[model samples]
Target: MMRHLDPTRLPTLHLSRGLVVAGLLGGVATASGIALTTTSGWLIVRADEQPQIMLLLTAIVAVRTFGLARPVFRYWERLRSHDVALRDLAERRTGTYAALVPLTPARLGARGRTDVLTGVVDDLTDVVEASVRVTVPAIAALVAGVGAAALTALVDPRVGLVLAAMLLATAVVAILADRLESRSQAAVLAARAEVARVVQLTTEQADELRVIGGTGSAHDWLRAAHVRLRASVARQSRGRSLSAAAVLVITGASTLACAALASTSGADAPVRALLVLAPVATGEALGVLTDATRALARARACARRLVELLGRTPAVVDHPEVEPPSRRPRGAWDPLRRTAHAERGTQGHPLRPHGTPRLELRDLAAGWLPGRTDLGPLDLTIEPGERVAITGPNGSGKSTLLAVLARHLDPTAGRYTVDDTDVTHAPLADVRRLVAVVDDEPHVLAGTLRANLALAAPDADDQVLVDSLRRAGLGTWLDGLEHGLDSRLGTGGLGISGGERTRLAIARAIASARPVVLLDEPVAHLDHPTAEVVIADLLQGAGERSVIMVTHHHVGLDRMDRVVTMQEGVPSHGQERVPG
Candidate 1:
C-alpha cells in the first residue's frame, strides 16, 4: 500500500516541519501536566494530621506552573498545526495544477470528475488535517498517557495495571473502527466522484440536452448520482459516530475500574489520586483514540486518491541519449539546406547556395490519434522566399500536417527535416526556436496587452511590438484603446474582438522572427477585404521566410508561389510533388 501511495511524493515538507513543532510543544505540555497531577496526588496522600505548609506550597507551585504552561503550549500547538494544514493544502493544490500542464487534455479527460477535484482540493486538505490535527495530537496524547500510567504503576501496581489494560482496549477498538471507517470513506469518495462527473457532463452538454429535449433525463441521472453519494456519506458518518461512542463508554468504564482498584488498596490512600488520575487518564485515552481513528481514515482515503492520479505515464517520452543539434548562424547556412544538398551532391555536399528551402517533409504520415491517419507519407518541400497556401475543406488534416511540421505531434511514419537535420530526433525546444505557429484562438493571459505580446518574445521592445501590430493591421485598433499597449485583456477585462485577437496573435508570432511561420485560419473571422489585406501583408512581411498557411479563403491565392489542396486525408497538388 505504501509503495502504491508513495507519501514522499507529496509536497509536504513545510507542513511536516510545522507538525513536528506542534507535536513537540504538545508533548512538553502534556508531560508537564501529568507530572504536576502526580506530584499533587502523592503530596495530599502523604499529608496527615500534622500537615506542613511547605508541602501545600510545593503542590500549589507545581499546579500553578502546569496551569501556566499548558494553555500557552496548547495554543501554540493548535496555531502551528492549523498553519501547517492550510499551507500544505495550498501547496498540494499548486502541485496538482502543475502536474496537469504536461498531461494536457488527455489525462484530465480520463480521470473521474470527483477524483480530480477532490484529490486536488478536498482529499489533499484531508491529508494535511489528518497529519496535524489528528495524527500529531494522538502521538502527543499517547506519550503523555504512557508516562502517566508508568508513574501510577510505580506508585501502585494495581492502579497502573488497570490504566494499561484500559488503554490497550481503547487502542484495539480504535484500530478496528478505523479499518471499517476507511472502507466507508473510500466508498463515500467514489460516490461523490460519480456525482461530480454526472454534473460536469450535464453542464458540458447543456446545449445538446436542450436541443434534444432530454433535460428531464439529465435531471434524473443527476438525482440518482446525488442519492448514491448521500447514502455513502451517511454510512461513513454512522461509522465515525459509532466509533466515538464506543471510545466514550470504554473510557467511563476504565475510570470506574481505577476508582474501585484504589478503594481496595487502603483507607489511608488519598482521594486526590482518584481526582487527578481518573480524569487525566480518561481524557487522554479518549483524545488519543478519537484522533487516531480520524487520522487513519482520512490518511487512507487521501493516499488512495493520490495514487490514482500519479500512476499515469506520459504519452510522449524523450530518448535519454538524444542531443540537440548545434545552432547554425542565422544568415550563414542556406535556409533551404535540404533542397540545396539534394541539388548539389547527395553525398558530402558542401557550400550550398543561399535562398534554398528552410523546411522539408519527406513521405510524412501523421495522425492525431493512433489509428486514424491525417496527413501523408507524401513528399513536400518549402524553399526560402516562398509562400505556400494550404487550402482544404474542414477536417482535411491541414492543421494536423502543420502541427507535424511544427513538431507538436510526431508523425506516425516518415521524417521531417529542418535545415537538413531530422527534427523527429531533435529537442522540442530547438525545433520551437526555428518555427512559430499562430492558432485561431490565441490564449490571452490575465495581464496587460504588453505582457501578452511579450510572452512570445520576452525582450521585444514597444517599437517592435507596434511595428508588428501595424503590419498585422492592428495599429489603428490599438490607437483607440484607452490603455494602448498596457490595456488589460483576458477573461474579465478590456474585451478585444475576435478579429483583433487573431491579429495580435499574428503579431506575437511575427515577433519571434523565426525562419518558418505556420498559420491555421488566421483570417477566418475577418471580412473579405480586411482578410485579403492581412494575407497580403503576411505574405510580404514574411519575405525570405518560409510560410505555410492553412486557409479556406482564396482571396490572395494568386499571390502564393504554390497552392496545395488536401482531400480525403491526401494532398492533391497544384505543386508537383510525389511520395518519396
Candidate 2:
C-alpha cells in the first residue's frame, strides 16, 4: 500500500505544456521590450540622416507597436502564469492535507505540532510562488536574450559574438547567485522558525513567565532569534547584490564591445545603432535572473522540507490480512447487562449506539521513543460498558497507555485486539471510528453551539444534539440558553467555565456515539467539587460504552467500575469495584 493515500505530488517548478505557453507569452513580452529599445535607437539614428517622411513612417510605427505590445503581452503572460500556478496550488494543498491526515499528532512530533503544521503551510506557499517568480522569469530571459543575439548576428557576426559572450557572463553570475542563495536558504528558514517559536511562546505564556520571574529569559530568547534572523537575511542578500552588480558590469562591457565591432563593420548607420543598443536591451530583460535564482533557491529549500515531512512512514499502519469478525466474544461480563434504569436510557431519552467492542491488551509495551518502553509489558481487558479509571504519577505512562489504546501509537510488543482480532491487521479508520478522545483543553470553536456539536456528528439532528448535551451534564445550561442550540461559544462569543468546557467535550464524545471514550485528564483544570460533578455526570451519561479515564489525581476513582494504578510502568489493579 502507498504510504500516503494521495497520488498527486507537491507542485515544483517543472516543464510542462501549460508552463511552455506561459513562458512563451512571457517571452513575447520580454522580446517586445528589447525590440522597442533597439528599434528606438534605429529610428533616432535614421531620423538624424534627413530621411524622407515615408522612410520614417514605418520606423515610427514599429516603435509604437513594440511599446504597446510589451505591456499587453506582459498582462496576458501574468494571467496565464497565475492561473496555472493557482490551480497547482489548490491541488498541492489538497493532496498534502490528505497525506498528512494519517501522520497526525503522533508522527508529526511529540510536541509543538502546531508549529510543524504552520511550517508546512508556509513552505507550500513558497513552493507555488516559485512558478511565477523563478520559472517564468528565467524562461523569459532566455527567450529574449537568445533572440537578441541571433538578430544581431544577422547584422554583424562580431557584435553578435560580443552579445553571446555577455550572455555567458550573465549565466556565470546567475550560477554564482544561485549557489550563494542556496547556501543561506536553510539558515534563513531556521531563523524564521526560531523567531516565530519564541514569539508564540512568549505571547502565549506571558503571565507564567512573569510569575516565574523569567521575563528576562524570554526577552533574551527573542533577542537572540532576531540576531540570527538579521544574519541570515544579510547572507541571503549577498547573492542578489552580486547578481545585480555583475549584470550591470556585463551590460556596460558588452555595449562598449558592440560599439567597437559595429563601427568597424560595413553596416548602415541605423543598423549599427541598433546593434550597439541590443546588448543593453538584452541586459534589461535578463536582470530578473537575480530575483529568479533567489526564488529557485527558496523553492528548493521548501520542497526539501516538504519531501522530508511527507515522505516519512506513518506511526501506525493497518495491514489486516482478513476482515475482523462483527460478532463480539463474551468478556468477563456482558456489556448489555445494565441495570433496568440504565437500560431505559436518560429520563426516557432514546439510547445512542452502544459502541461496546471488547478490547484486550496483552503484554503491550509501547513508548514515544524507540528502545524506551514508557507504557506496558502488561495485560488488561475492557468489556463493553465498562468504566475504568487509570491513575498514576507523572511519567508513569497513564497518557501513553491511553494513546496506545486509542490507536494513535502502535504497540512495540505483545498483542492488542478489538473483539477477538489483533488490531495490527484491523483497518485504522474502522478502529478509530469506534473511539472518541476528550482531553483537558477542549477546543470550543468560535461558532454556534449547534456547529460545535455538529463537528462530531455532522448528520445528527437537533433533537439528538439536545439529548447529547443534556446527558453530558449541560441540561441546565441548555435550558437557560435563549437561542438554544444556536448560541455561539468560544473566542468573541460567550466564555465558558472550565467545568463547562470539560462537559462540552464530553457532550461531543457522547454525540459521536463511539464505543470507547478515552478521557486524558479531562478534569485536570477543575476544582474538587466541579471535578466530582463532571465525573458523576460522565459515568451517568456513558450508556453501555467503554469509558477509560486517565487522571493524575484519584478524585473520581470510586465512581468507576475498576480503578487501575500504574507505578514505574507496572499496573496494579485495585480490589475496589462498583456495579455497572
Q: Could you tell me the TM-score of candidate 2?
A: 0.79
For residue 439, model 1's alpha carbon misses the true position, in angstroms, by: 8.1
Error of 1 at 370 (Å): 5.4
229-345 in candidate 2: lDDT tens per residue? 999999788767878999999999999989998888988999999998999999999889888888889998998878777777788886756333343354434322323224334
What is the lDDT, from 0 to 100, of the residue 149 in candidate 1? Answer: 72
Q: What is the per-residue lDDT of model 1 for residues 118-195, given as tens digits with 9 covering 90 to 100?
A: 556776776666777665666677776676678677766777777777678778778878787878887877887788
Candidate models: Cα lDDT each: 0.69, 0.83
Model 2: per-residue Cα lDDT at residue 387: 88
Q: Give the true-structure RMSD of model 2.
A: 5.9
Q: Name the regions of candidate 1 deviating beyond 4 angstroms.
A: 1-19, 30-64, 78-102, 105-109, 112-130, 133-135, 267-301, 304-308, 324-362, 366-408, 432-580
